[model samples]
Target: MYIDSHVHTSFSGDSDTPPEKQIEQAISLGMPVLYITDHQDFDCPPGVPEFTFETEPYFRKLRELKEQFRDRIELRIGVELGLQTNIPTDLTAYASGHPFDFIIGSTHVCCGMDPYYPEFYENRPEEEAYRSYFEYELENIKAYDCFDVAGHLDYVVRYGPNKNTFYSYEKYKELFDEILKTLIAKGKGIECNTAGFKAGLNHPHPTEEILKRYRELGGEILTLGSDAHQTVHLAYHFSAIGDLLKSCGFRYYTVFKDRKPEFLPL
Candidate 1:
């Protein structure tokens, strides 16, 4: 009954695992549902030229996998779009034309810098980077209404030079509150990405404190994902997260179909 809502295949520049291999891995790992959300960041970095979207080929392979594994596991086709506040119109148009089961809007870039590179935070203080990252995320979430969920609410922490030593939602309460408020107002859910645990962080990307605050702020929709790049990582740590969500006052997890959310009791 586990559903891994975020995954990337070889189609994404960062991953080399093919579509079939992704499916085989899912099956071997006993995942009942998997969503292939390859990166569709149009503003490719200098060294990352192949990060563009290949919708046709990606969807074609997805259609094939859906039929081929219809009985064994549920295959959901999805896209993870890097949200830039400046190009909201283009992002909206591109996402509108697709028939994806789920869409995860992410903030991979901030102030023209990709934090994935160590140099992005070389001379900058962790606080400054975190502040800018939250600022960009707030703007992107407010600008784009096409996505179903916001991916990895605190993804910037993973690559920051200081790591998690200096970052926490409590330190950025004002910005964090605004982000949660905007998402609540827009009816967009925040994803609980367990990938942070895999990266050696003590908690998920957005800590349980943020999840509690999100729930307290009247935010209802919350989705879960491992942000798995490999098959063995699918639904990783979800059992613990399910309990965590309940303690945080969320009784349900969400799923999307035709861009609408369906709530499942936790």
Candidate 2:
């Protein structure tokens, strides 16, 4: 069955689409399994909006939905954590105790600021900004060490004024290699985020070059996600994604349940 491992619902601070609407769209699209990974950034950057949700209430709603849609589609609850410098131990404890099917560790805020803003790029060249983002990513992952996968390796480049114009895996090969190496050594995975294609970037979030490099580095346990914030984007660009992954030498993809990996043949 085709699975979209990264998704969001109304529970996420940025999304307003109802949770059931998201599931209905997936079922209409013939997707048998999907995950709802709401955002939870404990310590958001200054001026950036905080993304925090009550776990018990969120899960309670999801549990009700799971029962309501039991025969229509298999729904899983997960969280996308924006990894920062100071990760709360209680946050880890909450996840450890709660039932999360998957968790994505992402670097949305770097150097106490969000790259999505214009000020984040002020007085800093894209190269330095991108480098600092990756540096923060590496540091955060090394310290947090609790997530299941890296959200988007090259996400920083997505917001640049040039916007991948001068971007390539080779340009940042050294740091990219280290990042992939660290994830592999730590038994973590990554995702093929399809949001970039919709943003007119004409590539996945990490780009094809990085995905191929991850394969070259013996990195498996990859998953497919649209990073959708609404129903219209539930499984965006999946048709082309299959061919893309095959060309990159991926024979299979992955899904998670109860925080354990499950492989599915391509």
Candidate 3:
């Protein structure tokens, strides 16, 4: 099984799963290493549960758990920072200051709204909204070089009105290519998120074509993640995700330790 590189626990605003429970589940699945990547979305819109957490206790707990489970499984501390261009918070400082093994810079919000909510799609063509999302993603990484990998490269599709029914890499080839090239130029990676399957899409977050394009662009830092909020969702569809990566020309997937990429054979 591929190392589960993305996960969540009570430290995240949306997840309530205890950290220990997630670790136990990983052990039960015989996963040798698991990265606990809880969410930290600064500048969330009003009237929503802000996706921020207390870092002191968050690190304290994870450090303790890392030691407690060292023999059974390796636990890496990670954070999924929601990237935005206009937010006032110093994301670079926060990301660089943390003792993170992996950092996933993701775009959960576009134009000051999260697509997960229906209103993000209201009155806008699904294609337009999707383009805006990618535009923001490109802007974010270019403005901030603090993350190890871009989490869920095509996450906007998961909440699109058609939900990948009409989505294709060719439809937005220019933007996708720019995004891939920018990531490769910056030495950043992207995650193959399996949550798309759970979200009713036929493929993973980035889809097979995008993965192949990233490979073609000479981008090698790729990680596989379930984006799991609960134990049951951990390592979802490992066999299929692994096969898809190999088919897309990947013989290895990645894990992070001390924020450095380590490729493991697929």
Candidate 4:
């Protein structure tokens, strides 16, 4: 059974896919498990309202889908929390009250800028930008303890301006190793986001070498996601990832329920 651990619906603010459409897409794709991890970044910049869990209609819709589709597919109510090290109280309060099946902690901001726009990296040195992004991610990972998994370990590389520039684990060995070690120490899984390939990067987020190193460091818990924003992107190229994971020594891909992880053989 295929499981898509990260996806966005209209609740994410940036996506247009409604909850029902997301469910229908999952069903059509033959994905047995779907986690609607609509983005919940609370401190969005000016003109961008924060996506709150308190949004009653969205949560209500999720509840409805969970019940309606329970027999057709295993629906998981999930959230992808955008992490900022400066606001632990806000993060804690937002997460504490939710009854989530999965929680994905992510760092979408780098050096006070969201890198979604091309202008974010306009004149900056690629290495400096990459380094700062990694540092910010590490900070977020350390600050948030309630999440089940760390989403897209090397997401920053996707928009590096200089696409196809190979970034090896050996190049950032110390920092990359620290990330894997921290995730293992904190008992959180790392998501193998396949969207990097769609983003013009040759490697997946965190790369195969990094995954191999993570396994070498005794990191076992791993999850997979397409980071799909559109229906056509669901489970995008996951079969290739299944082979990559097995080659990297990972025997299982994790699924979450009641915020607890369950291992499924690859």
Candidate 5:
């Protein structure tokens, strides 16, 4: 099974699943690596749920569990950092101060509002909202250099009114190409998040076409994640990932340890 690089436990604001339950599920599934990348979005705007966690307790609990299950699995500590245009220093400070094995830089907030909330798409066309989201993402990555990989590059689409029913890579080719080029130039990576299937979409977070374009642009550091918040969701829909990656021209998938990438045969 592919390593689940984006997972959440009780420490996250949106999840209540205990960390041990997630660990036990990964072990039961025979997944060699379990990355506990809970949410850590700082300075959330009004009306958005607070996504921050206490670092000391989070680290203490995970470190204890990591040692306790050392022989059974390789449990890695990771954080899903919420990338914002205004908080580059906060992100850099948090990343530099921690010893996390992996960091999934995510754009959860866009233009002072969250796309998950209905108001973000209230007054504007869905296409405009999506464009604003992409613009926010581009500004973020260009402003900061603290993360290893970009998570859910097309996350805003999942909650759109149409939800990919009319979406295509060609619809926004220029912006998408720039995003891919910038990531490749920064030596960063992107992930194939399976949560899209759970969100009622036919494909992953980034459509298959985007994945192909990333590969065509010489982006090699691709990772796979469930973006799961519950035990049943751990490694969600991973059984088909190998074939999908092969079709995307990926010979291998990535795993991170100590902030370094290791490619494994697909």
Candidate 6:
């Protein structure tokens, strides 16, 4: 079975991709399963559109789409939550009450600022900034338990000074192992986000070494997501994901229905 577990449509503040267009594209690409994971970063930094969404409206729209395309495709509702030390209690409470099929808890902002800008790394050492990101990530996962999977474990590397070229899994091995152990103890998993390839990286997020390490630690719940924000990115690079997962020691990838995982053969 073919599916994309991470995608954002118009509902996400940063994306212009409409839900209908994503569905049409997925259908054309032979992917019958789709997850609409719009962003919701409560209390995000200024200078950008807020990541919050009107939940009622979002659910209503997805319900309509599910019914409209019921025969041709299977649709799932999900959200990409920007995890932080202080969990948004109101939003998390509301999310718990909803019928979302999946949740991808991710870290975008590190130490009160996004690492996307040069200023975030201006004077700070690269290793220091990257370490803070992981520390915050581990803290958030330990403090919050609402999500099914942790997304883009080494996302900060994507915006580093020299980018992934100067980065290595060995440098962050201890912290990464801690994060993996916590997730495994909590029964959570990580997504193999393919967005890095589209960003000109030679490999996917978290690196192949990280994936193999997760498997070696007895972790099993792994999901594949394109982390697509537009129609053209839907299932991007999915054609080779099977072999990639096999090489990483994963025989199955995961999907969720009603917030429960179902393993699909790689």
lDDT of each: 0.85, 0.87, 0.92, 0.82, 0.93, 0.88
lDDT of 1 by residue, 19-43 (tens): 7787887787777777889999986
Alpha-carbon shift of residue 159 in model 6 (angstroms) = 1.3
Q: State the weakest 10-residue window (summed lDDT) of model 4.
A: 46-55
- Each model's TM-score, in the order given? 0.95, 0.97, 0.98, 0.94, 0.98, 0.97
Ranking by lDDT: 5, 3, 6, 2, 1, 4
TM-score between candidate 4 and the true structure: 0.94
Tens-digit per-residue lDDT, 7-27, candidate 5: 999999999999999999999
- Give the per-residue lDDT digits (tens) of candidate 2, residues 1-266: 36998899888888999999999999989999879999988878667876888889999999999999999999999999878877444556666888899999888888778888877788978888888888888898787677899997788888888988988888888998999988999999999999999778999978898899889999998999999998998888998898899899899999999999999987
Summarize candidate 3's per-residue lDDT along 105-220 as a digit string, tens digits.
99998888898888888997999999999998899989989999999989989988888999999999999999999999999999999999888897998999999999999999
Answer with 4 or 5, whichever has the higher TM-score: 5
Candidate 2 lDDT score at position 32: 90
Steric clash pairs (candidate 5)? none
Clash number for candidate 5:
0
lDDT at position 180, candidate 3: 95
For model 5, the superposed segments whose C-alpha errors exceed 4 Å read none
N/CA/C clash count, model 1: 0
Residue lDDT tens for model 6, 92-189:
67559888999999998877788777777878788888888889988888877889999989888888887887788899889999999999999999
- Any runs in candidate 3 off by more than 4 Å, and if so which? none
